[model samples]
Target: MKKFNSTIYMSGKYLFVGMLLLALLGSCGNNADKTNDTGKQKREQLPAQAGKEKAKTIVFFGNSLTAGYGVDPSEAFPALVQEKIDSLHLPYKVVNAGLSGETTAGGKSRIDWILRQPVDIFVLELGGNDGLRGIPIAETSRNLQAIISRVREKNPQVKIVLAGMQVPPNMGRTYASAFRVVFQQLAANNQIDLIPFLLENVGGISHLNQADGIHPNPQGHKIVAENVWRVIQGLL
Candidate 1:
């Protein structure tokens, strides 16, 4: 029998085995990390994408009136709107981004953050604070304009609703009159939806207001909800 060349055969076998293992290791390296990263990306993106599809939001962005300062939040007009939506089996989400004492300028400054997400219907309920603070009428109008412009710029398809608000005559007939007109001008200028007066039948009614004569009582919010619902019903 011929003696086998053990060194050559053994070296060839070992080299083949080594190369196969090297290929496998190179292929498998970081596969788990890659899977985790891809999965993480999917997890991160899924909720926002889902929210866009699943949420039909109405944002009532304003101040104390929107906040329900004198009553439970659920008793607020925005919350009442939500109740109506839910009762009617409407697919809508209400975001009450109402900050107490928020002025038109404040709303303007912070509105970019408010609009970071989807807004189907944007209800502008600001400027009352601007009026109360005796801020210049032109400045109030300009700030409100900027806020509305930003909302339109952010979501062109967003249906805007301007909620008309009035300041007391104590500010003098001229200032008070001009303040009321600001909202009318904005609603016409933007051609957006209008809630003629957020506090219609609720504003001056002593029984409807809290002691502050500013924030509404639960009864007051009910009237407000009606005002809003009447105007926005067609949109829904």
Candidate 2:
């Protein structure tokens, strides 16, 4: 009877030990599954966080040419610039802050409003109207300088590109010549990029202009976009 009792005790103890081991294994497995699940959740969320990144902005501040006066807004040079940036998958947003008949003085006044938002790259395209109106070169120069100073004050890190413009020869050789020199001097003094002549290939070309023979047609705007892209591409 003692031998039989000892055997039964041994059997019971072994059974209990086996059950405990099984329970421990199952708990470990559950913990491992939970860890894997947490890892997978984090991996899935990474792309969502990356997609939230905001694109930098490029503000095109100018007059009728930048506004696409005769053409559709989509046909404007600034819009076309946006298309180019999108095509390359570049992280940039273009804002066309153009107003028709905007002169250097007007730009100086309106710049404060435009600067309320962030500006990564600022393309200045004013002074053309000033030239057309035969505004004094000194006044135009002062206004442009003031606009540039305000832009820098708002954001010292801002990259500026000044669009050079030319008035009709009828404006007078001395006046037209002085007007053309203003852009060069500003670019040099301000140490910013210049597009030499904004309407390079399209300016004097009759077919490239609209009925007003001042603002560019759609095709002309395309060429103008190319001209701008050439200079700004390097900056980007």
Candidate 3:
């Protein structure tokens, strides 16, 4: 009888030990599953965060000159910028938002829609129409200010490169000075990059300009590209 009791006690103790080991193993398995699930979630979220570390985007916003006025779209300044980015293998996208005959007011009106995308840089070129139509310089300046403010509201850190325009001397010295000052003052106050004139090399030269004497020819577009590239490269 004593031997049988001892045998039963031993059997009970072994069974309890086995059950405890099984429970510990099950707990470890559950912890491993949880760790794997966490890692998968982190992997899934990685792609979305990847682009932020790649490169920035550039957006060209302006009027007829920006629309490749007299030049082919591929030979335009914006295209040249795209080419530069490609040749350098820079992970960037240059977007053209040019519209022929757009004034500062028109640009202001359309800016909200244009800014719907992720724009890392804005190359602003407007107010030529205001100069042509003899609009008040103050009004043109105000419109441009509003556009800048709107962009700032969307992104406080957005970099702006303003492509300034010079009116014909035929418009009178006072008007021309006012028009130029609109860009100068804004650039100074906002601490943004400024291209003194979009048509620096093509302006007033019949050979470089198209039949309209307003738009630039292909060779002229190359010069414009150089002008823009100078400022953009420095900032970047």
Best candidate according to TM-score: 2
Using TM-score, rank the candidates from best to worst.
2, 3, 1
lDDT of 1 at 201: 93
CA lDDT scores, all candidates in order: 0.90, 0.94, 0.89
Better of 1 and 2 by lDDT: 2
Model 2 scores worst on lDDT over the 10 consecutive residues at 48-57
Clashing pairs in 3: none
lDDT of 2 at 137: 99
Q: lDDT, candidate 3, residue 216? A: 85
**Over 4 Å off in model 2, which ranges?**
1-11
lDDT at residue 184 of model 2 (Cα atoms)? 99
Using lDDT as the yardstick, the better of models 1 and 3 is 1
Q: Compose the digit string of candidate 1's lDDT tens values, residues 81-179.
A: 999998987779999999999998889989999999899999999989888888999999899899999999998899999999899999999999999
